[model samples]
Target: MSESAPTRPLLNLDALFDNPVFAGGFGLASLGAVLAFARRGAISTVGLIRRRMLVNVEISRQDPSYPWILAWLSQPREQTSFLARRLTRINKLSVTTTTSVTANGPTRASFFLQPGYGRHVIKYKHAYIVVSREKQATAKTNTGEPHETVELTTLYAHRHIFEDVFTEARALALQAHEGKTVVYSVRNFDWVPLGEPRRKRPLGSVILDEGVKERIVDDAKDFLARRQWYVDRGIPYRRGYLLYGPPGSGKSSFIQALAGELDFSVAMVNLSEIGVTDDKLAFLLTKLPERTILLLEDADSAFINRRKREADGYSGGTVTFSGLLNALDGLSAGEERIAFLTTNHIELLDPALIRPGRVDLMVHIGGATRYQAAQMWDRFYGDVDVDGAYRERFLKRLDELELFGEAKEGQPVTRTSTAAIQGLFLFNKNDMDGAISMAEGLIPPKLEAEQ
Candidate 1:
């Protein structure tokens, strides 16, 4: 033990530092740590500067401005292309199809390719705007469609620039909707476009009973014009109309045409939709877009007997009768909303749902009448039927077939619907004699149903 202690002196700490291998390793480790710390500090400083100097505008998918900005950014112009290149090498595009889908897949039609959720950069007139799209917590919707938003950041913090951007974006969006009617439906407690904007249907094309269309249109115009009257009277600035008649009696068609006539968009509501609860209905009604028409088709289906529905093995919806009534004019019924309810069987509807306030006007859009038929015929031939030769023969054929059904009382109501007559005309297209000849062959649909 004595010999071993003598041989091994003390380990010198100074010598260890002086050794080449140990010293070199220590120097490298120290340098690496310092560099890392310096880099991290630089990054933090840059982030802080950005936070202080830059401004950002957040556009939510729920806002109408979201689509407007999207449309603006999706433009295939020099700026968009340049931005696409400088932002990222990855080109993520979303396909918007106006084409119809089939079992074979999607058919070919005009479609727009918009940038997907990603970072984009655009050089504006005097500023560099950065657009960041994200599908974060807001992506979830009841319809399962993605809900996204864009954050527009720029070095310039002026409000005018953002306003200008939105102004231009709105103009672009309106251009897209010009001469068309955009229909909307509810999803995730918000209204969303159902499909592509449809070409505006001419009001003249819709054939209704004498003065029916005029009366409804006049009432709508008056309601729109008299907003201040309701306000002064301390009444809800809302109007409701009920169109009740047989199926294919031009209820939906007239509604669409009326929307075109009023230059308003259509927000179609289905009370019996799977997840449309009473609360949802009230919220939707309360938050309808300005200059929008809310239409409820098959309104009687939901108001009909629930037990009867269950007995028929048809599980309806969550909207109850009382809930619907309250949604119509309750505390939160909302003002400035024009609601249109259509039903094939009005008798099935509860009387409370169509009282004075709820359904201010109940227009009976009955089956095809002589006046309606004549107007439709004149529309097809236009001024070419000036001699009235074809028109007279058509009316004679209608009488012989007993299509009007206004004859003897015991006969089944054979008044053919405008839709049925239109179908026949479409089948014969511009051939008056041909349509008259075919009318005598097939039994009218209403007659068959009643018989």
Candidate 2:
């Protein structure tokens, strides 16, 4: 049997007014007229009110005195009953509209209001947001007319997505002005792309075997904690990490993993490809976007054997040791900047660059541990559980071979030789499954493996 569809409810205007309570209420006839107008136009009461408000505002703008007369004529009883409240709301709305129009003139004025402080106007154009100090001055026009002019001096241009970072920086600047905090200004740095040959593989792609993943996570957590602590203390929250290890020890992979985990964009700067002098380098650093991870890969190669005072013909002129130092920790040092320097040889780096005040953390990634090797075996073989006896024998063999060290307590571990471990795992490709099972037994469980 077919069921009948339900009927929708309809508004009964007559019945609504027939009720003595509603009829006796104030402005009942006016309210009825409003409803009737809405029904005739197939519009809602909200739409009608909005249209009336806009019409009134337009009329008031054309004839500034018309609003008072219109209010008196349209709702004399309301004005008499709630004159103060109505006028207060109307005045606030008018002022708000006027301020909005003034602020959003020919050029948009970006302004934000802080609870305790006043409004701050942000000037944004192109890809930069200009932050400046606004000052009022009097100027004479060509016609000999005097007028007040607001002059703005550019303080900085922060890139997009770094707005929060800049906001914090601005707060820090304010505190510095009040002698409550130290202010560091970051130097401006430009990102110049190299016209080098493109590789067939995708840029910034890192592959991790199971064993190395765990270690990366642990180290990343530590890094994030340190960053948070700086933010909480309102300190210059910049971090400088040094990633050094063998060529194929997954140094780059670890970097990519960290960037991915932190959800920060990686801005890789190949120093060898940079043709800028010390002055330009300092500028680029100041202008780098906040909350960004700047990667200086192969830093050792860029400065290797180069004298600090040498005058190399570059785009920004001669670079000096003093200039380099100023560029790194100049007035424009921003708190949210994160810089990573990776090198194959740690010994090749200048002592100034690796100093405690320069790079905050120095992480040395060495060869893979035995735990890492076994984890890699399990990943490649897709077998978590292997024969216990065979695994023990294999582990003994690994210990005798000294393939990976035993996991120690209260000490930082290294998992460098990942490539070598991977190669070893694939050596017995014929019986890969059996080989993995045997290898797992030999690896110690105390050493944590990355996934």
Top-TM-score candidate index = 1
**What are the candidates' C-alpha RMSDs?**
6.3, 26.9
Clashes of each: 0, 32
Candidate 1 lDDT over residue span 1-451, tens digit each = 3555456658988999999999999999999999999999999999899888888999988786887888888876454566555753427778777765555896758778777888877765667777888887645545676768899998756545888899999999889989999899887688878877888999998999888999999999999999999999998899999998888889999999999999899998877666776667888877788788989877776675253325654434566676677777897678898899988888889888888899999998878887887888888875777888898888888887777765344323546778878888889786777888887544665556776
What stretches of model 1 exceed 4 Å from their correct place? 1-48, 79-92, 101-106, 137-147, 157-159, 186-190, 273-275, 305-318, 405-414, 441-451
Shift in Å, residue 326, candidate 1 = 2.2
For each candidate in turn, the TM-score is 0.80, 0.43
Kindly list the per-residue Cα lDDT of model 2 for residues 1-451, writing each as its tens digit. 9999998669888888798888787467788888898787776766676555422111221122222222222221222335333432221111111112343466433332221111222322322222121222443342333332221222233224244433544554333223111112222333432221122222123344343455545655676679778777776766677878667777766665565556554566555444445656566676564445677667676454255543654333344444444544556555567777788887767788777645777766666665555555555554634554444555566666555545565223543367755665567655654564554433335443532
Residue pairs that clash (backbone atoms under 3 angstroms), model 1: none
Q: Which residue segments of model 2 deviate by more than 4 Å?
A: 1-234, 274-280, 302-305, 308-328, 384-416, 423-451
Q: How accurate is candidate 1 locally (lDDT)?
A: 0.80
